[model samples]
Target: MSTTSLGASAPSRAGADGTGAATGPLRARRRWSGARLAPYLFVLPALALFAAFRLYPIGWSFVLSLYHTDGMAQTWAGLDNYQRLVDDPLFWKALGNTALILVVQVPVMLALALGLSVALNSALLRWKPVFRLGFFLPVVTGLVTYGLLMGALLNQDSGAVNWLLQLVGLPEVHWLGEPFWARISIVLALTWHYTGYNAVIYLARLQGIPAEHYEAAAVDGAGPWRRFWHVTLPGLRPALVLTVVLSTIGTLQLFDEPFIMTGGGPDNATTTIGVYLYQTGFRYFDFGYASAIGYALVLIIAVFGIVQVKFAKEED
Candidate 1:
């Protein structure tokens, strides 16, 4: 009887809920499974929130683009909204303005950023951390505050910039009040705002480039320009492509700087597709058209991205 008692197994475990169920190995496995799933359980709420907020809204916007809505009471309109975009004069104007900025501003900004990155990455540079910090500090500045400051500085009258020009005997140009100068103002603001950000990206890429390549280039009697053209440019190809595509998208959707700087004014001279879309939806309460505009911008960005990737691949 003692031997049999010794051989008898322990009683079933009560779960954490205190209801005795499976015993021994099975109970251990159930607990193990729950432990394995515990992390996912903890993460489930955040995933749910993301789906509810970001994913659901994105899906709904696409659906909403198919209907006409005055902020409410959406009615099925099929492709009519898209068709309307084709004929909208203001849409064309906004698109043209965006394209102009993309063409002019992207190259200039990227070129400046690339040069800055190279300078920063140079071993001969002194106080590298201080320079880097100063360049990057602008990125952390609040958008509205920066915009207001720039607007005040670039003001046609009684502004520091104009005052300096007058002091130097240069005629004061209407930076925000004229179409041509307004666009220039916008480009300057964008370049100032994002050059450091792009430079940081390029700097990371630059750091990853092997020193052996530069040494080899120098050993082959390559001068600074030749080395930069061959080794540096080639090493920076991926970064260049990334920044180009991103800058293109950003310029196409240009809004914040122009909005705060010019109010898309001097007669909508600085109005971008983003600003136009906002005006259409919020100001006019044409929700469907605005949704259509948003999707059109998305489509344009996708096309540009694909083209850029294809070009990069070809270069590869």
Candidate 2:
């Protein structure tokens, strides 16, 4: 009787909902099972599509890379295509040019974006809606249209930019004919296209920062510069990191600007990985080699993304 009494008084094991399991473990198990399965069930379709489209194609491409195919049974030529890429000077040059753009264009564009975002966020900026629309307009403009308009604008004879330079008594810049000038043109286009988008990103983030921090800084006698450096910058770090990583990837994969505007060069100065991939696969019919380049680019982007995330985490 004492044992029975003690057992009855013993603390009960609780189920997930904090109810006594002895009341209904079976029901609890059913509930837990459903909970466990729910997420997988919800994600099943996306997983299926990823497997079918992304995973399968990647696997097939790896297999294809090991062979020489004429759209039929491929003769195995292990590593030959990869070896060919090593000796391909044009490929290296294209990569170098891309690196150059990534180094130069990304920083300039992001800096402009950051400044523009700060300005737009300022209460001092009148006609906020109009200014926002103006900045964002270029971002949504069709790539083809931008390319055509820019091409026309950079035309040596009647281009608006050259005409303006001439009007200012400055030399008419040979915008497209020279390789350096062509590279600069692509950079200009990239900056024009993306700065607004980055600014918009930054603007959204800026709006989320608690106004109290700025108020506190002001209370502490922090000047506008000090408050901005302390409050605004820290708040904007995440957005800036995002902008950098995305811009890096975009610059690395850049194709349309160079392809449409410069046709990859006055002398291949504007060619990038994307254009290289196009030339390898479509123009040269070397899909396997192109796939290899694509995979390499994926790895590069992954590494950079990892580094950026790590740095951001550290900063946080």
Candidate 3:
């Protein structure tokens, strides 16, 4: 009877140990799965949509670039379209025009934005919210509306811009009819339209900076310019990088203003890569060529983006 009881107790003890071990693993697995999988559950929908829309289109366009057709039915032409792009002077010209805007307009616009942002950050400024709203309102305006408004303002004979020039004793000039003037006009219009936007971004960054820094600078007898260079500018580095990168990309892919106002014209002087792509794909019905241009834009933007990332990281 003693031996029988001991054997039964031994079996019960073994079974309890095994059950505890099993439960421990189950609990650990539940905790591990929850921690690892929770973030992905939140991100999955957005990731799915981005892949479905953006990534898929880019991949599809590249594949389409290898063929010749209106996308109705493509016949494989290999790399012929890309090869043709090498010798296409129009492509180079469009590229040069886009580069000019990137080189010139982006700096001018961002500088103005930074200045305006600094001014708005001043406590001396009255009605700060009103001023900010006034600046940002143009950015939210409909693109088509701005385009039409610009066209009216730049109209050669009676446009507000030319009329103002005439009133100032300057000869009435062809704002959009001439190549150099057309480029300048477009740049000015884009700058006017986007400056407020960049200012708003900079202002947000400026607000986040601790007020103690400025107070300390003042106590040290540092003037505004010195304070800006030492404190404000360092604080603005991130905002500057953001503005430069976004503005560079925006100018590189410039389309609407030129398309609506100059129609890429006065002899294709204002044609940008984006506008050129539109003309080739939609206007001339060359989907393959258009896809090639689109891919080229991706390459250009990638290079600039890489440079910006490097600069930002170096700053950090």
Candidate 4:
């Protein structure tokens, strides 16, 4: 009887140990799942903020574009606003002005920036830090301040630019008064403000280029221009593409300079798509039309972005 009782008690103890061994892995798996979730939990706040601010506003803007609102009553307008935009001569003029800037200003600014980056990166250049700071200063300055300064400097009569022109036996230019001059002034201001920023980008890319490539080119009897064309140009292609796309987008959304400097005036010669959108929305109180213009601008940006990407891929 005693031996039988001992055998039954040993079996019961073995069963209890087996049950604990099985539960141990289950608890560990639960802990591991919680640990794996920590990173996503940490990112939740930023995701929420982005959704609230950026994504929500974009969605609401699209919805608003489909409805006509007069700050009082609202009605569904569907594509009427878009049709109005097509017929609106001012919209076309604005688009033309923006295209002109994109074609003329972007290339000039980027070329100048590339040149400045090369100069700054050269070993022969002195006071490199000072040059960089001086060039970058304009980028850090407030847009409104820069606009006011530009306006004062380019004033028709007492402005410093005209004063210097007269001193040099040249006629005073109507920098802000005439249509052609107004457009030119806008381009000049944009170039001055953004050139340094683009140069910094190019400078960073320049620094990353391998010195061995240039040395090898020098050994092969390649002149400076040939080396640049073969080695440097290939290296800078990615940066060039990036800057071009950015400049295109910026040129399409040009508003601050034209608004502050010319008020889209001088016969609307400097009016851009962004300026037109603002005018339609606030000045004319055509919210739906403005939203439509905004979407059109977005569409233009998307199409250009896609084309740029495709071109880059082909080049690659």
Best candidate according to lDDT: 4
Which candidate should be chosen as best, given TM-score against the real structure?
4
Across 1-316, the per-residue lDDT of candidate 4 in tens digits comes to 9999999999899999999999999999999999999999999999999999999988888888888988867799999888888899999999999999889999999999999999999999999999999999999999999998898889998899999999999999999999999999999999999999999999999999999999999999999999889988899999999999999998999999999999998899999999999998899888888889999999999999999989998998
lDDT of 3 by residue, 175-214 (tens): 8999999999889889989999999999999999999999
Instruction: Estimate the Cα RMSD of every predicted model relative to the unseen true structure.
Output: 4.6, 7.8, 3.7, 2.5
Q: Write the per-residue lDDT of candidate 2 for residues 1-316, one digit (tens) a residue.
A: 9998777666442233456445588788899999999999999999999999999999998877777766545678788777876898987898899999999999999889988999999988899999999999999999889988888898889999999999999999988889999999999988988899999999999999999999999999999999989999999998999999999888888989889888887788778889989987888777778877777778888998899889999989
TM-score of 3: 0.85
Return the TM-score for candidate 1, rounded to 2 decimals: 0.89
Model 4: runs farther than 4 Å from truth? 1-22
Compared with the true structure, what per-residue lDDT tens digits does model 1 show for residues 1-316? Answer: 8866655532322243345443566889999999999999999999999999999988888888899996568899999999999999989988988899889998999999999999999999999999999998889998898999889999998789999999999999999999999999999988998999999999999999999999999999999999999999999999999899888878888888988999888888899999999988889998888989999999999999899899899989
TM agreement with the true structure for every prediction? 0.89, 0.83, 0.85, 0.92
Q: Which ten-residue region of model 3 has the weakest summed lDDT?
A: 64-73
Clashing pairs in 4: none
Residue 280 in candidate 4, Cα distance off native in Å: 1.5
- Assess the local accuracy of residue 232 in candidate 2 as a C-alpha lDDT between 0 and 100: 92
Pairs that collide, model 3:
none
Poorly placed runs, candidate 3 (over 4 Å)? 1-51, 70-73
Quality of model 4 by C-alpha lDDT: 0.93
Q: Residue 24 CA error for candidate 1 (Å)?
A: 5.6
